[model samples]
Every structure is written in structure tokens, then in C-alpha cells.
Target: MSFKNYISKLVFCNGISNSFKTFTALIINSKRYSSRFKKNTLDLNNNETFVYHLKSGKNKFKFYLRTFKGDIDIFYEVFWRKTYDRHLSFLKKEPVIIVDLGAHIGMTSVYLALKYPHSKIYAIEASSENFELLKVNTEAFKNITCIHAAAYFEDGMINFGNNELSYNQMISENGDPVKALSIETLMRTHDLSHIDLIKIDIEGGETELLSRNNSWLKLVDHTIIEIHTPYTPSDLRDDIQPYGFEIKSEKDSVLFAAKK
Candidate 1:
């Protein structure tokens, strides 16, 4: 924590407070829009129609999304930008393979595919419900391959503790007892080679995954991971260096690393 980072946190805290106030106002004023406005919004449950279409550069894309609910904003343009999207958009080429570990609802997968159509995406999600929606949302993209499995250190079965039913899929590296899988098995099964961008948000399992699978470091070029456990940033820094990767940047709890 430098002086600049301290000041940035202060600003971000203030901004978050203000954004919550605004979101509260929107919810309170939802009655003003009436049922007509709600009806006009796409029925995302039905996959027949395009919810909304936007052209990113020249390519046209469709996305099935609902507005914010219960004051969390729950939307990418709001929450994810501050942490993950900063360096994610640098990709724009074909034949590039992206590994999306812990891909929740396929939102990041859709973004990656739309941003880099020529690239193939290997999206891994363990949550049953979220993975289903992820599959539905990404059905249009030909390049995205969805995997409904958790990535871990050893090759075998492990408990997937999914209490929230939304996010938070942590591998039980310390015997916490959650869903588990073998990363080595997946690698051997898929015959995966080069990974251009890898995004991991599997709770505290990142440490165990990285520490256990030392061979995987050679497969990936860039990795963006959300670290949300007892391990300090310095611990992660020390662990990753041995695998030939160095931290490129970090915001909040998320770390962006590039291969050395």
C-alpha cells in the first residue's frame, strides 16, 4: 500500500457509498416505470429472442441480461470493471486460447468471446445453476467450450460446497470440504496446450491449485485471479515467481500476472 493506493481506496469507498444511494433510489422509484417497462424488458428465461444486441466494433452480439436487483447492481458494467476488466480487453486475435476458470454465468466468457472472436475460450464453471445459465448465454458463440467441472491440484473427486447457489466455489485445499477435481486430469483429458488468458476466481483454492500443479505455469501466458482467502498478497507473489510468473498489477483482491 502506497500513498496513491490508500487515496484510491478512500475514493472507491466513497464512490461505492454514493452508488448504493443511487441504486436505492432506483429501486424506490421502480413504481414510476409501471409493469409496462418491466414487460418490455426481455424475458431472458426464453432463449428464442435476442434480449439486446450491440455492435462491438464491427461484430454484432446478443446478450441476455436482467437489470440490477436488491441494490448490489449485479451487472458487469458496474462491479467487474474496477477489478478484472482493466487488462482483459488487450486481447484481439484468432487462434488465441483463453481459459476462464470459475466462469460464473458466462458473463466474462461472453465478453471475452465478443472481444476476441478468433480466439477459442475454455470456460470452466462448477456451479450447477450458474453453469446452466452460462451455457445458455454462450450458446451463440461457436468458439466457447464450456466445462462443468472444478479445477484443482490432484486428479480425483472432491466436495463442491455451494451454499450461496450464485458465486463462491472454493476448493477444499485445507480439508474445508467443498467440490473438488483434478486439474491434471482435465489437462490430460483435453489435451490443452497454450493458454493466452486465464482468469481464476475459485475462492482460496488458487494457492493450492498453483502450488500443486507446477506444470500448468507453462501452459498459460496471462492470468487474472481473484484472491479472497487467508493468504496474503506477498504469499501469492512468492508462490507464483517459482512458476515463472510475475505480478503485472493488482486491484482490490484481484491479481493480474504475466509469465516471466
Candidate 2:
């Protein structure tokens, strides 16, 4: 990590809470920093792999990190700092049902599990490596179901690209073929009658998925999607409006749509 990134992390850690700040300070003060924790800093960076055991609020997480492309900073930014959804108050279901596309290593899945303890989360990842880690990371959560398949408009096989940054993996004609499942098929296979929220971050595949026959979306109450503008047109809001959803675009390509 750069000097700026390191300092930013320290600031983020300090901002968590007085108790957490004190605990983090002890780690930094100890000369055994290298021994106590895996070196996640750029200076002592390990290219192969490392693990970060983190505690935020009342939730604990174990992240398996890789040096080549994964961004460890996202954990602090998204979960700890609440950069993605600051309020963490989007879903309002009693027993929430969430479909997480592009679950990656299950960070978001774990976040949802912690926030909504009674919720059922289906975490789907396309890449085999990411799916393996997804299962490992989420195995302890009985409410979380990890699937090694792509979410598309139809049931079939499509080419998928595996990237070192787990989030960047997407469907590409030049990549290897992988099984694809539609939203209806997933809901049917899992026996979900009504979906509270559908969180989509499937790179550019959102275009095709949202453009297709989305009759199944009537059962969904809300949706959070990250639109890839380069690969998809901005008129997706129009596409969803007809489905009785009111759309609001947020920073970082995120769109929030609630049922009207």
C-alpha cells in the first residue's frame, strides 16, 4: 500500500470506535506487528496469499487475501466505513430474501448475514476459484447458499472470464464456458416465492439480464444494481420503470430501485 493508503487505513480504524481505536493502536504500537498479523501492507506484501481476521462492530470476518489483484482496502471501505450503503437500511423485510449476483469471496454475503441474521441469501459467483472461496467463507452461515454458476437471462452455458480481482470477472465470449441460470430458474430451484431484494453486480451482464422478460421481478420488492455504462445503455432506468419500480442512481455506478 502507498503511504496515503496506509494513513487512510489508520484513520478509518481510528474512526470506528474508541475501543476499536485503542485495540488497533496496540497492534501498531507492538513491534510484533509482523508476527501477530499477516503483512497486508505494500512494503511487506506477499504475492501468493494471506489472511486477514477482522472485527467490525459485533461482526467478525476472515478474509483470504491474494496479492496479485484483490483489493483489501474494499473491506474497510465497503463494510467498515459503509461506503456502499451508508445507512445499511435498504432492505426492510422481516425474513429478508436476497439474491446476490457476483458474490465473489462472500464479503457482501457475510455483511448481509450479519445485518439480517434471519435472512436467506443466495450468493452466486461465476468463477470456479471465487466460488470455492465463496463456499469456504460462507460455509458457517446456514442462511447463505453459495452457487458456482452465472446469472443470465436464460438457462444455458455462456463464456466467462476469470479475473484476479474477483469482482471484475464477467461473461466474455473469449473466455471459458460456464453454466448460466435465470432469475426465475434460481427462484424456482431455491423455492423462493417472494424476493425482498436482488443485489446485482454482474459487471456488464446486467444489460442482458434486465433487458429480457423480467416478469419474475414482480415478486421482487427492491433491487440494487451496479450498472456498467460502457457495456450497457443508460436507459435501463426506463426499462425498469415499466415494472413499477422507482429508480435512483447513486455514486459508484450503483442504482437503487424500490417497488412503487
On TM-score, the leading prediction is: 2
Supply candidate 1's per-residue lDDT for 47. Answer: 26
Q: How does candidate 2 score on lDDT?
A: 0.72
What tens digits encode model 2's per-residue C-alpha lDDT throughout 1-260? 57886677666666543455444543343324333235644333333544545555665555564434453544555665565464245545543798899888787888788777898999998988777778877876789999889999999999997533546788887778899999999999989999888888898888888888778878888887878966443576767778898764466677788887
Q: TM-score for every candidate vs. truth?
A: 0.69, 0.80
* True-structure Cα RMSD, model 1: 9.3
- Candidate 2 Cα RMSD (Å): 5.7
Give one digit per residue, the lDDT tens place, for model 1 in 1-260: 47885466445434433345443433333333324345664332332221444344455554443332211222333333434567664434443878888877677777778767888898887766567767877888899998887778775666664333245545443433334556556667778667778888887778788876667777778888888768768877877787788888887887788876
Model 1: worst 10 consecutive residues (lDDT sum): 67-76
Model 1 global lDDT (CA atoms, 0 to 1): 0.63
Q: What local distance difference test score does each model get?
A: 0.63, 0.72
Point to the candidate with the largest lDDT: 2
Stretches of model 1 off by over 4 angstroms after superposition: 1-74, 77-82, 89-95, 171-179
